[model samples]
Target: MDIIQDLEKRGLIQQTTDEEGLKNHLRNNQVTLYCGFDPTADSLHIGHLVPLIMLKRFQKAGHKPIALVGGGTGMIGDPSGRSTERSLNTTEVVKGYSEALRRQFNKILEVEENENSVVVRNNYEWLGQMTVIDFLRDAGKHFGINYMLAKESVSARIENGISFTEFSYMILQSLDFMKLYEEEDCTLQIGGSDQWGNITAGMELIRRSRENQDEDIKVYGLTVPLITKADGTKFGKTAGGAIWLDPEKTTPYEFYQFWINTDDRDVIKFIKYFTFLDENEIAELEEEVEKRPENRTAQKRLAEEMTKMVHDEQALEQAQKISRALFSGSLKQLSGSDIGQGFKDVPTYETAKEEIGLVDLLVNAKISSSKRQAREDIKNGAIYINGEREQEINYTIGADDRIEDRFTIIRRGKKKYFLIDFQ
Candidate 1:
């Protein structure tokens, strides 16, 4: 069995109407598949990663992929898998988000201009062109009001009241799929388990559109499991919100830390979901989990591989450098960028332009409980500047302490760190 079959064996296929037929189709020729991304955020969260990973897997197995950015349907938010009507975003915001997300998508898949590579498209191209009359005459005729309401996505939100705009969302999505099928010859649609309703709507539209022609335009829908932690809390979300693919939204170090700190129970499953490690490599990591759990070999590798895949080699290297520096109690070699990325979690304080004593600033930043303690630490050589011990109690922290004219990393005692952002 190949990788797709292997994925199926591992229960990665949460729902597919015709799995055997799809497999047979793959056996014959390169299947053109698509997964749509709504421009809900500037960067995709971990929730979006599942289908992207599936698309990546399909691409690896010799298939073409269409990454559809929902520029049109985003205006009319999909009610499927939601309890409430989504707050609408402006067209300008959605357009900007779509472009940013496309760049991130390019990083994960083979999106180059080749036959088997990926192609990015926006539904707005067609949907925007269609007037209300055209939409109602051409696309709206195919969908029934009763059929739309019966969908769990719509029905679940009806009691609370759903807007007509959101109710029509599925029709637009179906149109997107049908348009791709007609123009791009895209044969399969993949999404999370929550998207079954939209996927089936597209499949049904294909059937109805060809009923008069006596032709069967078969399309398949595949969904991967919605990722959840064993603790029953959401995955890829922290108190800070979603761990984004874009480094600017969530820094490389923070992103690395998110995966590195995954619960021990979820590490193996995460490896399957997030990384491209082969079965044997995963098994070996599982063994390491048993023999030397404290080393956290699996989690670190998972973080490294994913961070490198999403960001770049430089971000991954910086994350690792900061991790090592923080862990080994040696941060002397860290640069200004390293300090900003590494110590982001630590508290920060801004000192006035006038010279201020280090001990007083430490107290002001709450690195020490009191000025007395701050003075004691400074006198005892427990304070550090750019990771070097500073013993002088009267040492004035000034322009000289600035790193690359951006930051000053202050160390209190041994492990605690605070960053002074030099404005």
Candidate 2:
């Protein structure tokens, strides 16, 4: 199937300027397409995956994909989806975020030395150098006040308030399209649903700039649907916070868990939106989801593919090991690193690495309320040390109880877990 058909099959295409024309444009030529990612944060989150993956889909179809990091426009901030004004980042901060995004795109997208390999660009390279007079005369002349105001991005914020800086963001983004079209022969721009106005505005600028020259401009825009959960809640978020792509921000294990715990109602849609699995494979997974929801086969596959794609095979294996160890309550098989990743959010206490009575340790770690309660928990066989029932009230926790001689796993009842860090 063609790229368009594949995207359609996956339910990825939300809005396209000219569906037929774009299908033909992609079919006939080695099209150069671009997607812009603003550096609003140091790391791109799971929400950014759809566009990033879309870029890969284009590249795989023998097209050049430009991953544009918004260094210039990021300073002004796009007002497309926000109800309030964005606090502008300093030059140094935007530049740092831009570089960070570039590095992340390099890892996520397939960057190579080949002709159709992904190319990374920063709008700051051009927008940063263009003088205000030149920008107003060349680009700003095409967009009338009414035209700018009519766009949903600006219109939605007019009631609440919109600043001139953000109001002019679309023009700056249009400059990016025009610049890329003139210099790189880029003919397509893709983004999330929120960017439709900006993308089309760029196309308009490209056409208007070449109107007097009598050149046929074929720029187009495409947007992926906004991901929504079956439940009323938002996607890519949990009680903790946003699910970041960076391992340091969200560990590989945590990332894996996020997908593994995909709601039954949203799992199938998520697999289609995120994974590159073929229709047949996806259909089979759908069957698995229907036949054996208890197995969570679909969720596991989604987590594996996502983990390996964002991280690596080794990271995926580690995440799986941690998951299994946690599920089975088999802490003995887990290494220190595995324990660290698996129990990262669990409560922890630190103390000297000396032998101590289990009851005293439980009280000190706050795992038990008092000596009496600690004794009761131990006597009732509700306390477990390193996944083993420790019914001995006088049991001493020492080197034998510590994992890697640095940490101990303490379990109260069935699920409450605590980490004891040895100094």
Candidate 3:
């Protein structure tokens, strides 16, 4: 199936303008479409995944994609998905973030040496050069005040209060599309459903500016559904924080674990949304899920593909190794690197290189929260060292217990485990 049809079947399309005409245009020619991502943060989160996945899908189906980093728009935050005004990021910060985001995009999309190798563009090139007078006359004149006020991004925020800077966001974004249309001949702008107003504004700007021109342009807009969870909460976030693409912000092991722990209800939906596995293969996996949910084949595939895409093969392997070791009572094999990379977030405590006993270390690491409780748990056969049950309250772990002369794994009960790193 074509990319558009496949996306529709997967329920990716939330809205589109000129659907029939756009499909007709797509049928005749491989269209060039663009999506903009603002660098609101240093790393893109899983919330940004839908548009990106769709971009790759289009690229795979023989259409070109332009990945626009909103280096310019990052200065003017979009109010579409927010209830309050955004704090402006410094120009230097935005520049650094934009560069990092583009570099990360390289991992997700095959954007080189292919028929539809993606093009990366920054809006600051054009937006920064335009004078206020020229911008108002050329681009601003095409938009009406009432129309801008009517937009949900603006209208919904008026009661709570919206900033003038955010109010002009679409005008700047529309200018981006107009510039791309004039310079790159881009005919389609695609984004999340929240972007419909801004996208149509671009189409209107193009039509208003090029009226009665020799080459008539027909720009299109398509939007994908915003991700949500089965329980009606947001996707890609938890009590810990937003799951980040950067391993430093969120470890590869944690990222892989997030996907691996997807609820059974959400796994099939995520497979349809995130993975490129074809319908038949997904169906086969779903059938296997019926027989053996414990195997979690579908969830594992999701974790492997996404982790490998975001990080790399070595990182994914390490993450899997950590996972297996953690789950299968093989903590003895955890090397120092694994302790550092895998248990970076797991609660840890330090001990003097000479005087660390197992029970004392357990209490320090918050395994039992108190020395008395630690002793009780240890005596009751609930405490473990390197995945082996330890009942002795006075079991002092010297340098011999260290994984690589630096760390020891301590377990409380069946599920909770802590890493003790010795200086």
Candidate 4:
């Protein structure tokens, strides 16, 4: 299969250096490539998926993928695609974050004990050893002030105050490219469109480093397009913050729902960018989306594929079960974890198991404003506890009411849900 052609068709390739040469390189042999991911957060988010999936794409195409963790460069945050300066993380914190990111990527990009397996690398090995003097003498000298200002990353940050540390990020990334080129023979670098400046800067370093020796050596850079929602807002953002890959930060159910709720306008594009399905499968989904938009078959498939890849079959089943139970108002079969994910966003209150009298609990838990309202709600049969209608004002919550003796699901009126923790 022509992977580059498929990527182009999916609208993934935004910018490239020597497209014809890159296509030739991938077609002819197993090309070694790398994409640098800065460890700015403890967990990888949906925004990080584009380049990560790009690495997986190349790996699937029988190319070598080196996921470069920015353990060293992460100390000095990259100013690309940021409106303000990032708070500097301590060396210890960066180390922790880098390890976490490596773990997450290791799961996504399968690294088998084979010749054509994905590899993980950290820039700290070399960058941590280099002195400020060596860095300035080696990489800083090659970068001209005019040339740096010409790059979009630096220019955009010039208006806003950008620190010297962040300003030197391009040099660090360039050094990464050079280091990988020397050690792993990685000739290509890929990233999001925002990384174009740093990417080309890396190519320039490679070219300058080999100026006298084998100047004909070809190093390329490719970038995926910036993802945007069909509504013209930013992707990976919601009422909650970013959709994190870590199940703790963002539950598997939430992650699956993010994709399952994709707008029809964006599903086909996402199916292409995110899924590994062949053309025929995607074509079939496209037809389903066109024919029956309400069925949400495309969205469900996208959710299933992504959830299974990120989490596992067990986690996917849990997410699916939570979704189904919530939709049908059938909460009896759900497990504690499932209920936790479903009611994570709902209002929560804590009370002793014995103290949870339905009427008093509603008022005290703020589900109802007053005792009168609580009584009226119960009399009107508008209260449901654990998916069962409750009209008795004297109803008392017990161990039986708790899902796994931890949580009690309380439905106020029809749609608003509340969660009560029974200690």
Kindly list the per-residue Cα lDDT of model 4 for residues 316-422, writing each as its tens digit: 99999999998888887888878889778999998776746788999989999999999999999899988889999898878788888888888987899999987
CA lDDT for candidate 4: 0.91
Go through the candidates in order and give each one's C-alpha lDDT.
0.85, 0.94, 0.87, 0.91
Best prediction by lDDT: 2
Best-matching candidate per TM-score = 2
lDDT (tens digit, per residue) of candidate 2 on 78-133: 99999999998899999999998999999999599998999999999999999999
Window of ten residues with lowest summed lDDT in model 4: 350-359
Q: For each candidate, give its TM-score against the true structure.
A: 0.93, 0.99, 0.96, 0.97
Candidate 3 lDDT, 163-203, residue by residue in tens? 88899998999998898898888999999989999999999
* TM value for model 3: 0.96
lDDT of 4 at 98: 95
Model 1 alpha-carbon miss at residue 53, Å? 1.9
